[model samples]
Target chain A: MTKRAGRERAGRFLAEGAQAVREALRYGQVYEVFVTEIAAARNSELVDEARAADVPVSTVTDRAADGLSETVTPQGIVAVCELLDVSLDEALAEPKLVAVLVGVSDPGNAGTVTRVADAAGASAVIFAGDTVDPHNGKCVRASTGSVFHLPLARSRNITAVFDACRKAGLRLVAADGHAKTDLTRVDLSQPTAWVFGSEAHGLDPEVLDAVDDVVNVPIFGKAESLNLATAAAVCLYAGHLR
Target chain B: MTKRAGRERAGRFLAEGAQAVREALRYGQVYEVFVTEIAAARNSELVDEARAADVPVSTVTDRAADGLSETVTPQGIVAVCELLDVSLDEALAEPKLVAVLVGVSDPGNAGTVTRVADAAGASAVIFAGDTVDPHNGKCVRASTGSVFHLPLARSRNITAVFDACRKAGLRLVAADGHAKTDLTRVDLSQPTAWVFGSEAHGLDPEVLDAVDDVVNVPIFGKAESLNLATAAAVCLYAGHLR
Candidate 1:
């Protein structure tokens, strides 16, 4: 359940908790829904909904459910859903706002950024240049079904992503902490693709140079900077609010 | 290294990664610094700074460093630092802007909120009523060492927290999705303490009732709600920008 190879081989992944499972049933290709006796009793409505969707439901013991669960406190309900990866071109074919994650390896940060991008009305999210797999269980759970809600794409070549964004008529904006221009000065109303880097490294110098512009989220306090996910939220929401 | 009891007994916690270790040395009571040989070579500046501060530096094998790391991909650098905690009264005594996390059990979320609070120029952060311990290794790492930048407090009683906020003359604002007022409409320039709840359950009814007002971070799109950490960032930065 934890390994990328395992999820890839099965072509399906587990979605835990009622909200995620329900979302999987609604927007994703669900193979089966697994619920412990207690979870079935607690979430009869969701189980019934899954059944109505023609999705198979399996009843497992609490111990078995615990074994299948990854979280410390199991939600007792898990859904097996087909992978939700879309090609970069397909994801960006028709987009207004886009979020490009460059080598964002932390599942929590990746998921949080996806959720924020979705919340900010971004049209698509692209995991570019060695970014963590979007299908990782932790990423899926952190996204809270956002991975299903929006178009998601992945690419190894960051240059190709930039080319696609340019072809899609999206301006490439890098979110850099050291940028001279602040985020507030930038006009995000136009179709724009915001690029963010990994936790350990900011955007590569080459990637930064290729972007149309680099902007910084203003830090009014003594703290060095915001976390990766928080920075993405602030930037994306700024675009939405603008 | 994982247990809260052990950290409490030792009155120290591990701060992982170069960023966190650097921040700890700059702003925290770092007792010792541990780095893998590769990290030592790659991060000579950090090692030199640590040594310059008269702090003990230890070179350990990658495996030993991994044993001390809480993250999946060990950053190869860790710092043993004194617990960064303050009394609730001390934290609230002179706070202008504050963040009060209620029942936020996820260490990642808790630490992210602390980091956001610091970046937003908040005077202090309080983990109130069944919240995760600030000294927890995961929480410390997630803070990116902002856990040391400002005062942090913990309380088992939410009511006591509210009482302290009231005594401090800070407006209590609870981040509620169902609230009538949107965050943009709220005047955040005034002294305030924003209260957030756990990922599973938002602010308890009792806690909500005791707060001065309830506000929601408006969702412009289909995402049901923002992740806890992201919401904190948006809300806190909104206050900062205002």
Candidate 2:
């Protein structure tokens, strides 16, 4: 099946590996689960969760499982569940505290930012451009199921999103590791849309151009940068709690 | 060969693949680098750095590379250089501010904590028990090379580390995430030692048993937990910068 086709087949995205599957069982809004014969037989935890949840569980060939997987290493288990579908319009109407992730490719980093957003009381998390899918198992797991709880979705038109946010009385705040604006000094109580970029390339230039304020977390060490997720967490925490 | 022996022979710790290697180059303090015949011929950025720095470089077989590697996928590059040894005796001599990592397994998490400690200007970082090796390429990279710049090392006896810290005037602050004390409000100005635990389990009873205060980064949303590295960063940034 095509990648999008596979995504469409299961309302929930595919998540693999024992730990990720375990997390799905515990926290993911899992509708149903599928496992290959080898994996199901070998990983009793998967079998137990499938049995305990009384969710429909089935077996496929390892090759079949491989074909369905988007990851390099598929843990032979997949779950189909409902989409998170947090609405931008709803979030804006309420508080206009939104988080936009731009071009972040790493699932772990993206998931982490979602977790940070959720922890910080972000009303929504908007993904723009080539950012990885939140439903990717790694992203889902990295989120620790925060994706299941937050207002999150993928949006292609970033400038338009910013425009709408501004129209809703939200200011765009971009987080740069090197920006001179101190996070502690930023006024975060107002309606705001905090934007973070890809771990490597950071925010796209176009997106950067649209931001109302470019801010930074001060760094006083020899290390050139913070991990993307860690940086996002600091900003989000500062934004909400400050 | 045994893991320790393999590292000893190469004068290098195991780094898994291209990503890990990229991280090491970006993050590790020790710059001396080497490449397997295959990796050098691939003419990637790492090989370029090795050549540019005029650091001693060499090539070995993929098999040899794997043997020397510390991860599942070695990707044919490794480095041999000094792992920094940090001394707390001096930092303790003044106002003793230390951060301790307990039972953290992910090298990335461990490294990022080290980097944050440096950024927060904590006098030292003390790893208690089987935390991931600070010098491991992944951890080093994750730290963004923070391990090299700070006073840091592992302690077999966590109690002693805490005792030493407490005696030197550091207040033991443990982050429980659910704790009632707001981290920002807590008096972190004292010589402080912040204790963090593994992502999966959080602070250990023994470690938490030793803390002077337990604090939380108040969450306004539904995230179940923060990424290990990100949580540490928030606490350090909020409480440690002097």
Candidate 2 lDDT, B109-217, residue by residue in tens: 7887888777766677887777876666677666655665666767667787777788787888998866778776788766678888887778776666678898887
- lDDT by residue for model 1 over B84-192, one digit each (tens)? 8888899988878999999999998898889888888889999998999997777877887788889998889888989999899899999988889988887666799
Docking category for candidate 2? acceptable
All candidates: CA RMSD in angstroms? Answer: 4.7, 4.6
TM-scores for all predictions? 0.79, 0.81
Give per-residue CA lDDT, model 1, range A54-136, as digits (tens).
99999999898988888899989999888888888899988889999999989988998898888888889999998999988
List lDDT for all candidates, in order.
Answer: 0.88, 0.72
> Over 4 Å off in model 2, which ranges?
A8-77, B5-67, B71-78, B91-97, B178-180, B240-242
Looking at model 1, give its docking quality level: acceptable
